[model samples]
Structure formats: C-alpha cells, structure tokens
Target: MIIGAQSALAQIIDIPNPLGPEGLTIPGLVAKIATWLLEIGSVIAVIVILWAALVFMTSGGNKERVTQARQTLWYAIIGLIVLLLASGVAELIKNFLTGNYN
Candidate 1:
C-alpha cells in the first residue's frame, strides 16, 4: 500500500511516522521534493552552461553563431540565477514550515 511505502520512506529519512499514521508531514514532503528539484535544476544549469561555452568556443568568427552563443550563455546565466534564488526560497519555506529558522 502507498501508506506502507510512505512510512518506510519516512523511516529511512528518520522523519517520524506514528506506527499507524497516514503520511509524512506536509513540510517534510515539501523539503524532500524541493531538495530533489534543486538538485536536478543545478545539474541542468551546469550542463546548459557547458553547452553554451562549447557553442561560443566553436563559433569560429561567424557573427550569427557568435550572437547565438552569447544569447545562449546569457539565458543559461539567467537560469542559474533563477535556480539559485529558488534554492534560497525553498530553504526559507522549509525552515519556516518546520520552525527551524536561524
């Protein structure tokens, strides 16, 4: 059952699941999902940055390609910025929800 799986996962993570309880707490779920998303986002962002750099390096003086690479690099940088902001926001939300602020 889904409940059994949730409880098992909760135990593995050391989050409590009262022997007969239903599910993990909302904040715990949010934190777990946010952590996954942030990790994926960071990996994608790094790949994009590398791809953009490769494009820029291989442009070979072609104005259009150079421009395209520049645009791609700028977009990747923006995406990284957004991801960084989201990471901070996620931490804030998780901390607020769990009352674990510093």
Candidate 2:
C-alpha cells in the first residue's frame, strides 16, 4: 500500500541537497541581490547628478535656482553615501560567510 511505502521512505536518512553552479547559499543570495540593488542605485544616482548639473548650468546666476540646484546635489551626495555603506555591509556579509576576514 502507499502508506507502507511512505513508512519505508521515512526510515531512510536525510541527505543534504547539492548546490548548483555559482555557489548558491544564503549569504551568496543576499550578496547577489545587494549587488543588483547597488547597480540600480548607481544608475539612478548618475541620473540625479546629471540632472542637478543641468539645473545648475541653466540657473543663469539666479540665487533661488542656484540654491535649489545645490540642494539637489547635496541630496544626491547623501544618497551616494548611504548606498556605498549598504554595499560595504553586503561585502562584509559575503566575506564573513566565506570565512575571509580583514
């Protein structure tokens, strides 16, 4: 009967699953996703910076416009810093999992 076969299968020991190519693991998966996010963020940052540069160039010495442009640039710089920190943390996690310190 099916129940008998199920019981027999349950008696067998559990075997670990094999990892496919590219060394898939929890940390590896996290690092891969983080890298992807970093790439996307970098692209967005570039776009924002370029937009800010264009704004500044078009401000034509107007104080208010220049202030807005500078603010945009400042925000972009903060975003870049946060993204860099996140990337560093991802790298740290990857290294820790790989047993590579310093």
Candidate 3:
C-alpha cells in the first residue's frame, strides 16, 4: 500500500488548462481557433458537395445537364477519396506519436 501511494504521486502532473486566458499565450489561442475553423470548414464543404451530388443524381438526364451532373459526382467522389486518405494518414500519425504498434 505504501509503494502504490508513492508510485501514484510520481505519475501525477499538475497541468493547468491552457484554454484559460491566464494560461494560454496568443499564438496558442490562434492555433486552437485555426484548428477549429479548419475542421468545421472541411465538414461543411463535404456536406455541401454531397448535397449537390444528390441533387444532380435526382435530376433527369437532360443532355447538357447530364454532363454537368456526371462531372459533379466525379469530383465529389474524388474529394471524398482524398479525405479518406488524409484520415488514414492522420491515424497513422496519431499512432506513431502514441507509440502504438498495432
């Protein structure tokens, strides 16, 4: 019991919340906001692109419009594939940082 208590004390770190004004610096706040904006913007862009494709698919093949619809669907698919690859890379980076072999 005494050894367990000593081990716990050694592992504890007193880190303050960096989001607090007193704790975070200007550059840190800017980086946090930028990260949030990038994530939100990516999600919004994906949703808009998917919605556009759905509308295009629902439209009957009216010559000129059919070509445009096909192009939109193709681009959306490519964008999604790119996002998937990025996600895979992110996971790989996360695992590497955490020293996870699996």
Candidate 4:
C-alpha cells in the first residue's frame, strides 16, 4: 500500500503555461525582451542614483567629489529618461503593427 501510494504521488503533472498561449509567438517574445530590458534599466538607474547620493553625502566639502557626484546623477537621470522614451517607442511600434492604435 505504501509503495502504491508513493507511485501515485510521484505521477507527473503538467503545469499550466505562465505566459499564456500567445507566449510562443514572435510579438510575445519581443514584448518579453523589451519588458526585461526596461526592468533591468530601471534597476541600474536606481543603483546609479543611490551611488551618486552616497558619494555626495560623503564628499565632506570636497569640490571634486561633489562635482563627480553631480555628473553621475545627471547621467543616470538622462539614461533613465532615454530608457523611458525607448519603452514608449517600442509600445507605439507594437500598437501600430497590431492596428490597435486609435
């Protein structure tokens, strides 16, 4: 009885697909890649901002360190803006191709 129960419990079960049925298509793959890039870019932006803030806080009135931190912060901000714009452009292209835009 124990062996039989163990065999029954060990039976393979199919798990439902997480990305739904459309995940296998080209558009779905492109969207997934774009989403991942955006997420990673946002994370990098946050890290850069935090590092700049830390540098600014610990500069102790040093002009060079303060200048470096300012530059870093500005660059990170610009990168974040560009990332946002890219994401918007991708969305627009996808909409246009799908004929979903009004």
Candidate 5:
C-alpha cells in the first residue's frame, strides 16, 4: 500500500524540464527567476509588516517597544517599495531586450 501511494504521488507531481521541448532559454529562465524573487520579496515584506503591526499592538504602553515597532514598520515599507521598483525595472529591461516595448 505504501509503495502504491508513493507511486501515485510521484505520478501526480509534474517536474518541469529546465531545457524542455518548449525551449526554456536562458533569458526565459532569468525572467522566471526574477519573477520568483519578486514574489518571495513581496511575501517577506508583507510578513515583516504584519509582525511589526503585531509588535506595535502588543507593546503594552512601552515607549521603546513602540518606537522599535514603528522603525520596523518603516523599514518593511521601504523594503516593499524597493522590491516593487526593482520588479518594475526588471520588467522594463525584459521588455527592452525582447523588443516588446510597444
């Protein structure tokens, strides 16, 4: 039964070929990596923002903790903004290279 289940799971998992019939070129791979990085950065920023908010809420009238939370919130916001700009720049570069700037 365990072997059968493992086989079923393996069959269900579709592992993509790095250089498949669909022509996974270097530029395409770089673009996909950039997109994944942007996605991960965004998620991290969101998590940091939420953690800062929680810290702020749980400070219990502590001035130092409140200040720390505020700083964390500001840093997270800045990081998120930077990530967004970086993604935009990456998209622009990709478009320029691919001649899709119409």
Candidate 6:
C-alpha cells in the first residue's frame, strides 16, 4: 500500500525547472538579477545620499555628528561602487557563457 501511494504521488507531481527549457540559464538569470539590483540600488543610493545630506545640515556644528554623517555618505558611495562592479562582473560572466564576449 505504501509503495503504491508513493508511486501515485510521484506521478502526480510535476516539478518546474527555473534554469532550463523555456527559461533563462544560470548565468543569464544571474545577469538579469544583477541588472535589477543595480536599478534598485541606484534608487536606494539616492535616498541614502539625501539622508546623509540632511544629517550634515542638522549637525549643528558638532564635530561628532559631522563625522558620523560624512562616514555615512562615504559608505553609501562605496556601496554603489561595489554594486556597479558586481553587476559588471555578472554581465561579463553571462556574455562569456553565451559566447558573445568578442
């Protein structure tokens, strides 16, 4: 009985493939996700920049607050740099895999 039930369940189940057939391959998927992340990251970076500017403006001439705001701004810049590089790398990988890396 158990064996018959297991066979019936297996036959009724159809698993979908995320990286095969009609969908994007692994590298292609990664590149697509990276592109989306870059777009989202750009928006987030802009918000962070605005927040950091607000912090600086409200620092009231305090050295500690000014330094904190500066650090936050710098960190945002660095995060953008990293995001760009990562997206670039993903593109390169996708191109190389697709044989379009001339």
Q: 43, model 4: CA deviation in Å?
A: 0.6
Worst 10 residues of 2 by lDDT: 1-10
| 1-102: candidate 6 lDDT, tens digit per residue | 354445645655579886667888666786677778899998999899889999999999999989989999999999989988987887787688779967
Q: Which residue pairs in model 4 clash with each other?
A: none
Model 3 Cα lDDT, one tens digit per residue, 7-88: 6557767887758847787756755775675577578657767776776777776666667776776776677676667656
Which residue window of length 10 is worst by lDDT in model 6?
1-10
TM-score of 2: 0.69
Which of the predicted structures, 1 or 5, would earn the higher lDDT when compared with the native?
A: 5
- Over the stretch 1-102, how does candidate 4's per-residue lDDT look in tens digits? 354455756878898887775456878878888999999999999999999999999999999999999999999999999999999999999899899987
User: Between candidates 4 and 6, which one is better according to TM-score?
Assistant: 4
lDDT of 1 at 60: 93
Which numbered prediction scores highest in lDDT against the true structure?
Answer: 4
Q: Please state the error at residue 90 of candidate 5 in Å.
A: 1.0
Top candidate (TM-score): 4
Name model 5 segments beyond 4 Å from true: 1-21
Better of 1 and 6 by lDDT: 6
* Candidate rank order under lDDT: 4, 5, 6, 2, 1, 3
What are the per-model numbers of colliding residue pairs?
0, 0, 0, 0, 0, 0
Q: Flag regions of model 2 displaced more than 4 Å.
A: 1-23
**TM-score of every candidate:** 0.69, 0.69, 0.47, 0.84, 0.79, 0.69
lDDT of 3 at 49: 76
Candidate 5, residues 1-102: lDDT per residue as tens digits? 354445645645678876676878788788888888999999999999999999999999999999999999999999999999988998898889889987
Clash pairs (backbone) in predicted model 2 = none
Which 10 consecutive positions of candidate 5 have the poorest summed lDDT?
1-10
Clashing pairs in 3: none
